[model samples]
Target: MVNSTTGNRKHFIYTLAATTLFISTYYLLLPVLPLYMQGMGGSKFKIGLIMGLFSASSLFLRPLAGQASDLKGPVKIMKWTILLYFITPFFYMTHSFVLVSIAQLFYGFTIGAFTISSATVITTSVPLEKVGQAIGIHSIALILAKGLAPTLGTLVHTVWGLYPLIAITVLFSFAALLVTWRLPEIKPASKPGDITFRQVLTYRMVWVCSLVLLSVTLTFGTIMTMLPLLALERNISQYSLFFTVNTLAVVATRLFTGRQDRLTQEALIAVSLLLIFLAVMLVSGSYSLITLIIAAIIYGLGYGAVYPALSTLVVLRTPSEIRGSAFGLFTAAFDIGVTLGSVWGGFSEYLGFKTIYFLASFSPVIGLICFVVFLHGENVWNKILMRNAAK
Candidate 1:
């Protein structure tokens, strides 16, 4: 038991470290890319198109990535994908939106594969009883990178310029590649190609959860694509601080609720959705840094808990043989939401940021309603899963 515990701890730390490093490469560009594209003669819609391409490509790759995770060890997918991160940054040096679009596509593929594999590692390898806490802790890596790297990226861009920022991003991706080498590659229980993506998606809860995740991710996608531009327009100079504050709030909330019983999933998910709705509404009305930070805190609180809770619900009920496929479909929903959010940025040229934000705020509300109306209750969801698992 002592040895197993020690090994789990080691696996956990390695996964977190690799993820933080890998994701930081992308987050570094998240805030800077909008401004960069705008400077390069891209309009708001064009900029959004380019930005959305990242998640669009990620959305396409998720199923293949998920399947690969189930067939081979996750570590193989992780290592090769991180290498794409290292190489793809060079494409951005061309300063062409076409090339930038190409780079974004590569990035989408890399992140989709890396994240699914890393998540598979955590969900499958960890003790089943502790999956909730493990997932919550695993999320900290994303939150940490999302918080700190944008600030650092913006700072690096300000001090040095775009080329240096790209170089720094390359360095981080390489570091992630190295760390991933240390991650243990636990084999999935299923034999190679035994499970199909169709089998996973056919499960009602999987697609339902995916749609619910999509609604929230749409809000997040809009925020990621638009918030920097919004802050710039309003003269909120320290806009990156929004990410930092949001990160802290998410981390705090995850820590507090990470150990809760899975039986309370419905309540946890509903409350999380409500908090996210309120946060988006706040952003639509904010004109100052303080308001943005406040919105971040609320958004963090809601966004932080919903993902892990929803994910835990799916994985707990899934059979071990197809967990990878289910997660692949589930996370692909995230990519769709983000893609839609980015596409919404195209409409900004017509609607303007405040109006766009105001409209986007309803996404989480839709998700909440879906959860309540479609899910009906936890008992219904569980029965569905239990029946499927038996087959």
Candidate 2:
């Protein structure tokens, strides 16, 4: 039931190529955009607002877009959205916040639609049993972007300045569009959006899985914001080394353990959540640099496995008819968690880092309990209740 025929290799390659370009372009811009906004005389609040707008709009619009993909097909939505990805960057040339904001609105449409449609296409196109493997491959492309794009983006901006960086990103956007065109399109398995936005938003497991991912990401967000400050306070200069080890461990975990057929997606997720808890626990105790590194490795294993496994679980657990909407809801959950975590990181210092890290470490425990109890434990309890009633 676990390892079956992987769908189409050609489509997988195309999807990988398109996502890598799209994700890479997005990642490349992620760090550079704030600097651009700052240079344009935007205040810190304005910069935050500008950055926040992209995610805010993207987060809210996901379900609608997902439903639309179910009603329509991937090709039309993808064509327009991909074009916007190629076009949105030019608006920054105006050096105006209003224009940039508008561009970001369209950017939301670009990514939101592309996310649902591309995921739909990839999942539907693959063999029913290979969803795990397919999702793993997809996550590999994304993880690589997470691993490499920011550094590359910063390097480009540092060496050639913003305009050149913009140009390089623009090129990738266009390349993504081209690659997207080649990716085979899939119509909704459901009859023309028979599944409404309400259905997508209300899917029980999506919400549960989202909470699980959110918990882990919350911990990740905390580390990202706090670790550097923690390092500076401790006078440990090789803070960047944490990222290196973390990224490497994540990639290694995926390439190695992810390929094995020994575990189910749900089981993998459960293990990952445990790793996240341990990682944060170690990080909370880190008075020394070695603890941080060890914590990073543990967190990497958890993160690398959970991401792909959860994606596969989402696709598998949801009804095929409304899978696009399912993916949208999941995406929304993931993004909202990161955004909140980032905000939490900023506010944590007010509470003192030690207290905050301790709380963050403990927070995921709630997610673990809820996920297991609701997803599995509740089922057993229900069976017992039914037997007693029958008696």
TM-scores for all predictions = 0.95, 0.81
How many residue pairs clash in all the candidates, one count each? 0, 0
Segments of candidate 1 deviating more than 4 angstroms: 1-4, 377-391
Q: Which pairs clash in the backbone of model 1?
A: none
- Candidate 2 residue 109 Cα shift, in angstroms, is 3.9
lDDT string for model 2 (122-233, tens) is 7776676777667776777776676567667767887888778889878887888887777666755667637876666455667778778777777775666356556656
Candidate 2: misplaced stretches above 4 Å? 1-7, 34-50, 91-105, 201-203, 221-244, 257-263, 280-295, 348-358, 377-391
For model 1, residues 120-172, the per-residue Cα lDDT tens digits are 88876677888888888888888898788899999999999889999888888
Ten-residue stretch with the least lDDT total in model 2: 1-10
Model 2 / residue 272 / CA error / Å: 1.5
Per-candidate local distance difference test: 0.85, 0.71
Compared with the true structure, the alpha-carbon lDDT of candidate 2 equals 0.71
Model 1 deviation from the true structure expressed as Cα RMSD, one decimal place: 2.3
